[model samples]
Target: MKIKNQIKLSILTMPENVPLARVTVAAFASQLEFNLDELEDIKVAVSEAVTNCLVHGYSNDRNRTVNIVCSIYDNTLEIIVEDEGVGITDVSKALQPAFSTDPERMGLGFTFMQSFMDNLEVRSEISKGTRVTMTKRPQQDLAAAASEEN
Candidate 1:
């Protein structure tokens, strides 16, 4: 499929980033034939990620900006959430459901992303920042593919 347009939005490391995440995700989902389930999944997953960056990554420090870049290429939608804060020291245990640095956090953001999107990738450095990237593609049209192949 031909890519129509790809959009990007940058947000500061503030609680407001949560709403921005929601809006940006919805805009991308609007381009496809997503059902309620798909839409909700995307929203929840993205919200959790953005919240993680704003809260944990920046430690609620709104002075820093969390760079969120999204691109719709080919049949795939890619989202990257980045924060210039303390990077994740442990990757394996971080994705667990109960793993969290804060008492109030459930530490399920990455897990939700795995459940919602087709692909989830996380990268970070101790002093650099954390970047969470996710990619979801439009459901494959088997009928169209078959027709084209024939």
Candidate 2:
């Protein structure tokens, strides 16, 4: 589908930026007329994706950068989060529900992203970086809205 609009952002890989990343994406996604619960789900999914970049990719390094790109289509919202830090050695292992390289993490970031969005894709190369792309389709009254628009 053709994109209606897009937003790109680059922020430091600081712990504090996680919320900012998610909130900004959610705000952009609000144009789709999502209800509160749907908006919260998008926010949570974005938070998890950004937190993974901060905690695992950058390893909490404040100097590194996390890039976020949000796009809006007629019926979908697409979000991409990426970091140029240490990449995952095994993408499949990382996607496991309870597998984590760090002892403190629960390793459910991918799970949450997959559950919340209609599509989730992760690409990583060791020593290069990781990129997460997710897509969500809104569930508003599109039939009525389309008729009204016509």
Candidate 3:
């Protein structure tokens, strides 16, 4: 699917901005044919990714920044969240279930993103940063939808 629209936002690494990221993404995704459940899933996935940036990436350092990019493509929506904090050393291990750098955390961020979105890709460099790209495709029939709209 071709991209129809996109938005980019940069916010301080604050816990309060997590909701802002989720709501902004969900609002942008609403332009597509996603159902309420699908919108909720997108929001959850965005929340997890952003929270990881604040908690794990920046270590609760509110002075840091989080960048979020959301793109709408016909029936699909892509969301990218990034942070310029200490990057993950083991991307493969991080993707595993219940694996967290912080012992106090459950480390289910990647799991939630995987379960809620259709595609999840992560790239990180030590002492550099981490970028998480997630894509969601609606379950509705695009052909049927087009015919109905016409």
Top-lDDT structure, candidate number: 3
The global C-alpha lDDT for each of the candidates, from Candidate 1 onward, is 0.79, 0.88, 0.91
lDDT of 1 by residue, 64-138 (tens): 887777777665777888888889999777887778988887777788899899999989899788999998765
**Tens digit per residue, CA lDDT, model 2, 1-150:** 898999999999888888888888989999887888889999999999888888888878788899999998876899999988899899988899988888888888899999988899999998899999999877665556778899
- The better candidate by lDDT, 1 or 2, is 2
What's the CA RMSD for each of the models? 2.7, 3.2, 3.2
**What local lDDT does model 1 show for residue 40?**
81
The worst-scoring run of ten residues by lDDT in candidate 3 lies at: 137-146
Q: Spell out the clash pairs found in candidate 3.
A: none
Q: Global CA lDDT of candidate 2, please? A: 0.88
Candidate 3 ranges beyond 4 A from true positions: 142-150
Query: Which parts of model 1 have CA positions greater than 4 angstroms off?
Result: 1-4, 140-150
- Candidate 2 shows a clash count of 0
